[model samples]
Target: MAKNGKKMETQRSVDQEVKAICDIMRRGNCAGAMQYVPELTWILFLRILDEMEEQERQAAEAVGAAFAPSIEAPYRWSDWAAPGSEFRTELFEKGQGNVFAFVNGPAYGEDNKTSLLPYLKNLEKRPNATAKQKVISEVISGVDRVRIDTERNFLDVLDKVDAITSAAIDDTHVFTLSQVYEGLLLKMGEKGNDGGQFFTPREVIRAIVRVIDPSVGETIYDPGCGTGGFLAQAFEYMTGPKNEKIKSADDLSVLKRDTFWGREKDNVVYPIALANLILHGIDKPNLWHGNTLTDQVGYGGLFEGAPPQFDVILSNPPFGGKEGKDAQSKFDYKTGATQVLFLQHVIANLKKKGRCGIVLDEGLLFRTNEDAFVKTKRKLLDDCNVWCIVSLPGGVFTSAGAGVKTNLVFFTKGERTKRIWYYDLTDIKVLKKTPLVSKHFDEFFKLLPKKEESELSWFVDLDERRKKAAAEASPFKKEAERHARAAAQWNEKLKELKKAKPKKAPAIEKAEAKQKAEAKAARLAAGKAKEIEDAVYDLKAVNPNRKPEVDTRTPEDLLDLIEAKGREIAKVLFALRQ
Candidate 1:
């Protein structure tokens, strides 16, 4: 009875320890949090495996069944942590290959003779190995005393290991540390590192994600994957358990390793990408360090035959950099070394029917240099579904000290675009002071119309406009003329108003001659004319086109028309002039 109680206590303690570790890992600091318990996992796994083997050996002895030891003696957790003398040093000298060999040999085999020799040897040589061995020995002895069937529910134990190790490092506290590190990096104020240009506003990122709506299991690539924020958001959207009925194991796995890809050129941000991936639960990410626009990695091509075509391509490439002659010469496009190269590269990388969302300077929409580049862009749009253009508010990048107006363009390849949706978010008041927050995105998202519009938004049909332009052969010219005519008519009306004169008072009765007439005769005449006009036409019938017709006529035509009209108008005006 005493032995059973001790075993129960041991099992309960181990279970509790595992739960605590997992909680820590989930909430701990993301960067370098895994470093704290680098070897803790190897030790825990060994102790559990040894206990199982020992149980089988004891059970076989009772049943008179033949048993064999699977693991070697020195490789067991007990051997390493046991009142250690020189075991830790021996493990380190054996290196990684021997460590694996010793761990896999005896305690895990048909014969449980191979000890945890490698682990003991490793602990012996570590700085302060004596202290580490003491603590590890106590922990392992306590774990071994548990007579639980770990195999039936190994996951529970695994969870505990994960939790405890995570807690030991404490990620929640670590995240604060990470923020401090990022603040320091910002304070360093390094340029040409392209830190300012590469850092995409979080609100902008969220907006892009909302518009694109990338689905799970689809390959999402960000060629200029700065700090991996965009990819992280994509992962969160796909993996979020809200859609558990729709999400599957395959979906999660694809998102974890296969579906995501990113490339960053700056060395400073490469580690940031890795750290971000880990924080987002992407254990084995396919991230690379290279200038994706120019590098020949993964898929090598100037334009055709790009590897691993993406379903969604999103990026905020660096702006305002002059490419050198050598760099410019390398590009296939006419723009040579400007940020336009990235635009072209993004287009090239996208799958034929893939969708893309990018943030670019407003000038890219209408720039006249490198006709080939412009023509290429137009051709791409002509063959694709040019969906929406959102003009962002100014001071969006106040933190970066760049006040350039940026726009988000949404387009899909392989579909003929009839109209492009344009959202003028620029007019919306978004900034308050130095640092911009996510509140700006809230209003923009609110005002954004669904596919079937109701209000506050309209579509511009490019296809109809182009067809009309081609039919007329000069629609733009005609439009220009219409504007000019409108301006001329406005000027003529202003000139006539400037030349008009006030009217004189009417003659008074001889008896009332001492009392000057309070009302002018000209005002009475004007009121009478207004009444007649009002009677002739109702308010709704008042002609807006009347001013254009009156102003467009020659000076002689206007004078003749005035003379033909009631002579009271001319008499009153002529007397007032006198």
Candidate 2:
């Protein structure tokens, strides 16, 4: 009984270690673990399966039924744990093939020839088998020391993994490792420049999440989901335990399985996003790989393709600056390629009365180019509730070397936009000398306007702005009036000064002129005396008796000495003048 307890305790410790390893991945270190992915995933899957199988076997024994562990004995946890025992050798030491084959499924046989045993045998004989086994064993032992099942829940384990992985990554750590694994795609868009267009800052994601407040059961979508940051945040907001009171179990499940959807143009990041969603525990998300601007994914009457529309849409569309050779040709708003098309896609994807939080460059707010596009955007604003526009500070993407100022525009479809709330945070300090060490978001969040009124934000009526614009026909009238008043004042002053002009020279002028002449004569006499004294004290000219060593000295040396003496005399004269 004591030995059994010790074994169980050891197993519990291993689970904790596994949790810690995964937690490290969650912090953004998965990229470092990329080399170990195949091994780590395989080992972890095996361990989990082993645990599940053990529970099944114990239950079967208790019920008086004959039972056998599905996994072969050689690959069992106990056999693998024997100190210094190389499981790889037993599985594939000679010409034997993959080990995972037999251990993965059933035994190799003529009737069941497709068993995993052959593959496992082959895998053990691979050239790097020893190294692979070592890595696998080390990871297993490391995780084995942690009692994950007893000390932490599954979600907590996932979070720890996410933290670990994210911590390992550099700038791309915003989306947790699970998010990356579950379903967040990152692609190098057009010459790598357009990537920033869809790169959403974490603070921006939080702000959008706060404003949209995505509830359970409501579908959320990002038509231009770059790395799935926005969608992942929405997922967390809806399913996180903090929201349990407000969200029902059924609603949360719906959110996990059916509510989240996204579309991406690049194929590379598609897997990333899918993995991100999966890591977040969303099974089979409705994400698609296509140009949302041109393609349809039929969600409700929102688009031609689907019936269930999204209740919330959050996106940081690529900034419409310039496009490369591989850019999409069918886009009508190709002049402002990225952002304009994404705006249209967002509008098309949103369900009636749906809310949207989008980040756009400030130019979109007042660009005269592309009149039709501008008109469409403005009309959408007018038809909807353009709730707020939070202007973000520059230098948010300083690491990318692009400092384009951006703004978050929140709107709700089918609602009247009588007043638009504007929060001007353009002058806020968002970045420091080191891009990663700044604390701009803290103060910004504090000053953010709640549902209540605040000094940092105010609502401006559209009608009042129109009135102000119309009343400013003669823009320079006030300046012209002020200039005319200043000219009149100058004329009046000139007339008064002319009448007050006066006076003549007196006898003091003659005395002053005589004093000046006497002072000049005295200065001349003193200068002559100083000249005579300098001549008398001139050592180079007076020391004729000290002449020697002329035969040993070169002409150049004599000239240099003469030059040095002349410079010294000049220096004395210059100092006296000062």
Candidate 3:
């Protein structure tokens, strides 16, 4: 009861903070909360960083280890943003009537000289500056967007931001500020900020994470991690109470600093991702602020001196975006399409036996029109075991304003795929209305490890797929050839008949023409009938012992047989497991 009460109180606090910030954001020439949320995020990040650093200092003292503050005294959150603070008073009330100039402008400080932004930037020169301090400096230097009109208004908003934390009040409900921050990020994505490309649905992220099952020490990465959703979800999955995989504080430390990594190219979106990670408790996130498709040698920050290979990858690279010849030159399968290039990159960068769960556009699934597209699919099958594909329902991404059909493709490198299990999720009603939830994937999760087949899920063996493709292609070519040969014979015979026609009766000529036409029609009908007979034989032959009579089945009858076979296989699998 007490815990429930605390949770309810925290819920109230979260709602209050969001409403307050949004209301304050709309007050002046200031735009909507979407533009201003980043500003609030930056401020909240500093405050959280200071508090986290304090906690670390205490922990170090307890263990008798040497520790120091990341951000030095004067520029720290307590010194600058805390109410009744000295720096706050000096900047706002002391000396001149240049409050806005003091912050937004370049002017005087403690000894009557330094500006706020300039002083923050000067922190970089401090010897032995920690990684946390470096991130703080980087964020502050890029904060030219916080355009509050008055000092009072700024202070009021700052106060509201500060109060969002449980530590700011006398409540025992210690809520994580990351939750509220993520909520704001969700809202921003819903508004189609940055074209809604930077956000993946949380349910989709969770479902992918559950299947991937990232471990504690595994180096998990997202090549195009938008808002760091996959990495964040992976962290939570590994650290959950049921997951005792993380055995030590050292493991926890590694998970915090090194495990989760990503790259974001958009300038507007990079800061949100960075701030998002910081708010999620990563002091030093290994996120590169550049395109993931950039050449590994040219971009050394994330890749280091050599190519980067990871144990697991979760990504939803941008679809329909073009990378021209220059970008295509870096990849083996050169295509202007962004998703195709990302697919090649993911395949190349994954370590042998590394697993990947990627969301790709529908075009990548069946597009064999281009050499690059065919080669990409061929390479995927040749080098990876594409075990499952979950076809996501349309409008799953509509909240983000994307209407393209998407699929979650799961595969592992260094193995040839003999068969691919496909799960058709397009028919689920909840996905169209209530949207996807983890429960929607409950049955999929159960059947996935077993490769169990259901009404919505079926297997397509590579050998069978290849055979089907060849058969489909051969019939068209062969039929066209047969028609051409028959026409040639008819024309040759007609010339001979024309020469002899003067001597023969017109009635006899007409009867011969009718007979020839009927014969040609009969040949075409027989050819089609033979094709249907062959398909039936193949279907029945799947069960080798059953030599059923030659009975031609309709399309519906064929579908029923396939479903029955799937169920029988599923039962056998379950029985064997038992």
TM-scores of the candidates in the order shown: 0.50, 0.52, 0.76
Indicate the residue-level lDDT of 406 in model 2: 74
Candidate 1, residue 575: the lDDT equals: 98
How many residue pairs clash (N, CA or C atoms closer than 3 angstroms) in each of the candidate models, in the order given? Answer: 51, 81, 2
Name every residue pair that clashes in candidate 3. 109-113, 109-114
TM-score of model 2 vs. true structure: 0.52
Model 1 alpha-carbon drift over 4 Å, by segment: 1-194, 241-246, 296-307, 325-332, 429-439, 442-456, 468-578
User: Residue-wise lDDT of candidate 1 within 290-399, one digit each (tens)?
Assistant: 66655745311111222467889988877666655554455566564356777777777788889888888755665534453565566656677877777677767655
Cα lDDT tens digits, model 2, 55-164, are: 76898999999876544566564344222347544544433333333344455323455343233334424465542232222223222222223212322333333223
Candidate with better lDDT, 2 vs 3: 3
Give a tens-digit lDDT track for model 3, residues 218-314.
Answer: 8888888877888877887887733376788888888878787787776656667777888776656777766678643312233232237899999
Full-model lDDT, candidate 1: 0.53
Best by TM-score: 3
Which of the two, 1 or 3, has more lDDT? 3
Candidate 3 Cα misplacement greater than 4 A, ranges: 1-8, 95-102, 105-107, 110-114, 119-128, 166-175, 241-245, 296-307, 430-433, 470-578
Question: How close to the true structure is residue 3 of candidate 3, measured as C-alpha lDDT?
Answer: 19
